[model samples]
Target: MGFELPDRSVLPRHPVIVGDEPRQSGSGAMFCHLYPANGQPTGEVAGAGAADVDAAVAAARAAQPAWRAMNGDARRDLLLRYAAVLKQHAQELAALETLGNGSPVMMAGYAPMVAAQRFEYYAGWADKLRGQTLSAWNNPAHNYVDYEPYGVVGAVIPWNGPVFAAAMLLAPVLAAGNCVVIKAPELAPYSVMRMGELFLEAGFPPGVVNMLAGGPEVGAAIVGHADVDKVAFIGSGGTARKVLQSAAENLTPCCLELGGKSAVIVFEDADLAQAGQMGLSGAISVSGQGCVNGTRVLVQRSIYDQYLAVMQQIAGHIPVGDPLDPGTVMGPVISEASVQRILGIVGKAREEGARVLTGGQRLDGEYADGFYLPLTIIADVDPASSLSRHEVFGPVLAVTPFDSEEEAIALANGTDYGLGAYIHTRDLRRAHSVANQMQAGMIHVNASGEGMQPFAPFGGMKQSGFGRLGGEQGLLEFLQTRNVWMNLKAPQ
Candidate 1:
């Protein structure tokens, strides 16, 4: 069967959403979207420009006071209702995600509910953010700290997982009583644009949430806006530098979530079957475009060959085809450029003496037009090679062998990016020791498929970018602290 796409009628026509209404871009610029499944024209939407970004920011600024002034219980109730609305339209949003981004329908289906869960999780936190009452050293004085919202937040999300990224930032931002302007990725803006509409339907104030669908210029404008109190960005580190440069002009605080070259370490005593399956899945899930994917695999030398055999068998059997097909386990990357880039990295790895155990080439025949690459495993990868050091952001796994537990830990911490690390081991003490030594923000032991939990902190370390995006830390990202002191002995 051929690839199937979602109905265009379900997509929003006007991508610039302000004050609870979807409207045309002020600049009248339009951008077309292509279906990654077949590289066919999906449709076009008006692209936001500097003017539209300014309008959205202005709207958010105007709405922030009222949003913040509302009682926390009221804000919590609205967020809870919004979560329900997201669940109600989960399938519709999932179809839009698969249509534009080429994630398999089965996997894409989880994003909406994941978003809903985030909202629900943060909803409980809405009324629960508390401040500290400090003991004063001076005579008869009361000292306390207050958490205040940043007033306005500008968020820039990438194309790979728009809905999830939107929820990741938006849930905590909104619950903390901040108004926001979200710059949806031009490559895949459908689901996020619809998300803006859902916010209004959930009875949020008119200007509380605004979304702009555009390219880099719009993102730049949002980051540089002096009125924007805070900025949250999720994308490549290169782009993050540009964002930082622009944000510096206004001295706006920023929270960035960038790319990773996460590592998966497997000890000899590990359940090789489980390690191979989950380790490969961690590297290739989301078509290997995830920022936190464990694409670099470090195995103990004794079981290195045995692990490669298991990985090769599993990778070869993984289904890679039309994203809409329920049976398809892997789908196309974001675009043709992504396919070329991933293939180029694989080609360079081979030149550096990395052996392609399975699936190093792009698929042909039925998937010729689409940007498809099967799950690739390259064994004998040199730890010092570019393949092991840089982020491929594709479904390609680079495996290197380590002689000891300490060697495995060194290899896992060898990269500049420290977003996530995975270790598969039978020994609990080793798991704890290695996990403590891993430089990444999040670590998984004997498991890789649990995914992001809403209750814990999610972020990276070092070059992977700073700032937490889940749990209480995420909520605090949009808030500022204020210290207050009052004299209790005034009457004396």
Candidate 2:
């Protein structure tokens, strides 16, 4: 039933599953979703309301002791086996993601694949969990610390990259010996359920990993649940603020992975071709839905026109069609609301005196139901406009010309966000200086975006979000430190 790509406008005649047991409900039973590939309604996902959250939490609370008692090696084995299961069902999982979210099929598949890799990466860290030692000057004794896990981790994921973000939280939370109750996003629940199936196959104790699916109520319930020790959330800054407020009641430690309006800077001495390619790819990947996307381009005034010409030519050709189509490089913007939001930003940019270089039209031809926005490029956009300072989350790249290194750095750091900033310069001193000046979690030197790697840390400094998600820091976020003091002095 899932293999066939239904038309975007019509609802599919199926239902997405809820639990490990093939307990199914009719379409729209739980979630209000359409096929992401075509922007049509698919089968309804069964919703797990308040009662479901309680049940899942109870299950997790009950199983926590035993699951926590298990050694890290055993957990590692289970995760490795789970990784294998994901690999085996990758095709099925990928198709589900593509259908549930409107991203290109290839792009949708990326989350599941990366999620599996993430699990494997954290699985290796299970046994490597460690603490530290601190010196106590006041007393003649050895002082140290131990890393420990909080009991039940509540994971609230966003629709943009449901599987990956969930895995990003879950992998480390589990590896740190914490049981988790994951609440899938209302907009994209299918992929989360698919992940649950993989976990079940990985042989995690039944209650150790539970999934609750529904809307805001369900997520709120999970985060506020008394038994849940920590909350890991990935969503908008507005939503994240509410989550933080909600979590405050219980003093639950919360990690918020929020939004961004990242910058990509181009200097005259750099490789223009590489800069253009990375700039276009960074802004357009995931249709500009990613939190770390390079939506703002700061080019040196000398080469601004040349860079625009190259960028315009390349942006014009980005494939926008059926996400399932192998040739498609860009897809719909996830929802109609997102499309409207992007359009509003474009209008605001024009009012602020930005020039539309190319692609400012809403595409309705070929795929009528799909919500595809043109690969838009706005030149000479005011740095003060929302398009330059806020996240549009669409295929729109705003370019602003800058003169000298100080202005480039000043403009890049002007926004409230500090997620990611990119710089391209052949001069080593200039690149290093620019990289240091930008106030962001990650700064890409001579590259438009940070290439995917398992080792590097990826997170923002300011409003982009608190806490790291990848690399050693990511794993550490899920872990807590405990000091252990040892005394060699003879008992007197």
Best by TM-score: 1
- Candidate 1 Cα outliers beyond 4 Å, as residue runs: 24-28, 449-451, 490-492
TM-score of each: 0.98, 0.93
Candidate 1 TM-score over all chains jointly: 0.98
Residue 208 error, candidate 1, Å: 0.5
Q: Residues 1-492, candidate 2, lDDT per residue (tens digit)?
A: 122464533322222222344234422235667655456676566677677777777777877788778888988988888877877877776666777676677777767778888889988988787777788775578898887778888898888777778778888888888888887677877777767766766667778888766788888888888888888888889888888888988999988888888899999997988899898876578888888888899999999999999998887777777777777788777788877888888887888888999877788767556777878899998888778888888888999999989999999999999988888889999988888888998888877554545556777778888988777898888778777777767778
Model 2 C-alpha lDDT versus the unseen true structure:
0.78
lDDT of candidates 1 onward, in order: 0.89, 0.78
lDDT of candidate 1 over 171-270, digit per residue (tens) = 9999999999998898888889889888888899988999888888889999999999999999999999999999999899899999999999999999
lDDT of 1 at 435: 89
